[model samples]
Target: AQEVHCLAHGLAHCAMFCAISGNAPEHPVISTKSGHLFEQSVVEKYIESTGKCPVTGEPLEAADLLPVKVASTVKPRPLAATSIPGMLSLFQTEWDALMLETHSLKQQLETVRQELGHALYNHDAACRVIARLIKERDDARQALAEAQPSAAVAAAAVAAASAPPTSKGGEPAAKRAKAAAPAVESSAGELTPEIIASFEATSKTLSKGRKKRQPPADQTSAEALAAFGEVASEAVLPAGPVCVDVHASEPLAAAGGADGSVILFDCAKGAVGAKLAGHSKRVNAVRLHPSKPLALTCSQDKSARIWNTDGTQLHVLSHSGDVTGVTLHATGDYCVTSCSDKSWSLFDIDRGSCVLRVPDGSGGYTCAGFHPDGLILGTGVDSVVRIWDVKSQQNVASFEGHTGTVTCLAFSENGYYLATGSADTTVKMWDLRKLKNFHTIEPGAAVGGLAFDNSGLFLAVGSADTSVYDTKTWGTIKSFASGAAVSGVGFGRSAATLAATSADGILKLYGSSS
Candidate 1:
């Protein structure tokens, strides 16, 4: 049985190949620890990087490799050349390939070094800025302490004086709420009552402000949006972007390329502002923080990264499989990412910790986003839209109607509606207030991305084409299918700008150029 008729001669052969490359080693070497043979260069690189034996994973070094004195050396004839000229031609071709590979490695090394240099420079700049901000914060804190008695006494009077809202970013109820919340940093990642209360407070504040918010004065008319077209010739993505997001308040957009890069471009200026290079595979989705100069992106690399306008890496959250979607919490303090690993996680921005990681037992999530109220999260799994209570990490509701896999999702700014796009070539609108799928539309293509502009004027869906529809009437404002199949779509404040990234590497900004 040990020497079966079919393989008896090969099993007992004296010839050995490198454990790493499975090729006859020119100068064979054996690990003293693991007793495994290897091609010297290949194993040495592994040992150098990980400091462990290739097979045994024990401590290893180049010096541990002992050169073998084989009875005979034989070069592999994988090409099976039958004549001298054929062998010579194979050798010549191999030599050329080796030379080219060496040149390519050198180029990659140079590029890595350049990237390292830029990273160090950016780090230094960030450190300086952080130091300045810290000093200013300390000074301000001291001044606040000194003025506390008078300010406390005159608080009601000052409130009557029509001073600008003291809250920063909704104008710092978050800071105040954090102070008041009992389990502000609950180590167990529980949604405590105090935390829920804070969420309610922020949600109420934002919802109230949203009610009075108006479209920017420069917002384009619906007619202009119906005639949407490329306003600039500039795009920064090195290739076709797989996903994109337009800044709600700034003339900026972020696009994720198939090459695993995120380019932050200024739509107003028609130039690239920053390059976010960390993902090792294609980026699947990207989202910009509502008002902060921050970005969130998920990728096939099984990680979601948060970055700032300065190209500084804020956080990197890892997952078990390709991360399909990422979304920011309404308050900008948390981000949620869904992955193909049959799970999704909520990460706290300031603490850099996963508050909760929920198992998606039904199936891996295809897309995800937060409710405008910040108290709820919606995720796509199979054809169902599962809504979770942010504080409790419990599935509170599900919208089920689509016959195909859900592909993308967006929450309306009004806090009452949720839009789920599916591979069934349809987008469904669910009323969160009623917990029901109220409407659905077939866009005639698989929906890839979805967005609702700030003013609740339109919904942009990306598929074979990108279409903008009036939110109230569900009527198409425009449908753009010109350049290439649309991959992602976004809307600037009040639909002042419509940004669409296509499969042909064009990031088109459509709106009144005024």
Candidate 2:
């Protein structure tokens, strides 16, 4: 059933109110030209009272009323204000709320923007701080790098200036002072601080000779030539002794006579141990084994004789031509001999056989030396020192700085450096690590023999005036006038006894007369 409401009138037809209540068929209706419905009794009452229709106010009688016709069979439920007008009012209220929320969100967004800007500012400041710190660190490092060298140089200069005028026993006081002078112009200014330090350290250390071996207590003088004793050669060597060696480990010493004789001497007592006679010609070179009781001698007789320390002959090595020089390997298992035939031969001692023979194609080989390791050989030719790798049978390195025939070659104990002496009166120090000559010294005479001490600290070069130099600085540590041209120079195993063989037949011994 449809709910009826009185909109304009209190009592109306049976039909639903057209304005207030929607049209429904289940409601009884009474309508006329006004298109409204009312109850039949209400119309009759209205006609009896006012004699007109309620809506239209037209004159109407009860008998003239007609019922409105509807097609729907069931009555519709009553509805509240759910129409377009009501929806429009609700939409207006929702639109106002949405506007308020948008305004609040805009305010929050602005606040977030301000906070983000502050955070960005802080990040930028932190970045700047980090950049500044990095720059400062780099600057400090650069400053330190620049200051260390200057400080080191200044300290070195001060120390040198404060040093005493007299040297302990090496270079002359004036020469040392001149060499150590910081302002003495040279190539040092072109080198780095580290390189300069290296050069300076070498100079300082070399200027001070071995302080380890104190002179004998009985000795009172630092004389240059205090001959301990002399060993006389047999039969009066006509051409003088050509080569000499001293066994520092023992009190034994040997000298090769010009008449192809080797004279052994007991250095401590200054007595003759034995006299070896084998070759028919002059002995050119002789070397005693470092630890063994064996000695090797090469002669112009085209033979090299290996002798026991007791002067007994062990083996004989025959060469194709006059043997000029011979040196044994540190191990005593091998030896190298240089001959006038422009060839150098490597011999196995125990096997008594030649292992390899390398010919100097350009010039006659004058001297041969074996490295400490016995893996390489050095041969001196005209103006060049050729280094051969024994295993590969190939020349590994060649040094050429000498203007005359290369006469002598000596390897340092470490086997990393080589000292080559030439007849041009120059000795060049070659560093094998770089395969180049590092330094050169003029000995003022034809270099006959070169020897590096067992410790590799001192290098003795035999010339007109025998000169001993510190290996590191290549500085002349001491100079001894041999009275005659020095033919050979060597230090004993202990490096305390220095022997120099000159044209004079007498074997000169230099040491403290303990």
Overall local distance difference test of candidate 1 = 0.76
In angstroms, the error of model 1 at 228 is 3.1
User: Model 2 has how many clashing residue pairs?
Assistant: 6
> Mind giving the per-residue lDDT tens digits that candidate 1 earns over 431-466?
654445678878888887899987777899998888
Q: Per-residue lDDT tens digits of candidate 2, residues 1-514?
A: 1322232243333346433234433434455445566655555667799988777888877666555444455545335345877777777888999999999999999999999999999999999999999999986764553333224334434555576665568544221112122121111112235433543454334323322334344322223323333332222244674677777467677888777888886667756778888989888898888778888899999999888888789999988898988987654666888898877776777766776676655567788887655555777767777766544334555566678888788988655678888888888887655456778889888887788766767788899867778766677767777766777777765466677777665566666555
Worst 10 residues of 2 by lDDT: 175-184
Model 2: residue 393 alpha-carbon error in angstroms:
1.7
Considering only N, C-alpha and C atoms within 3 Å, which residue pairs clash in candidate 1? Answer: 167-171, 167-172, 168-171, 168-172
lDDT of each candidate versus the true structure? 0.76, 0.67
- What residue runs in model 2 are displaced by over 4 Å at the alpha carbon? 1-236
Query: What's the CA RMSD for each of the models?
Result: 32.2, 33.0
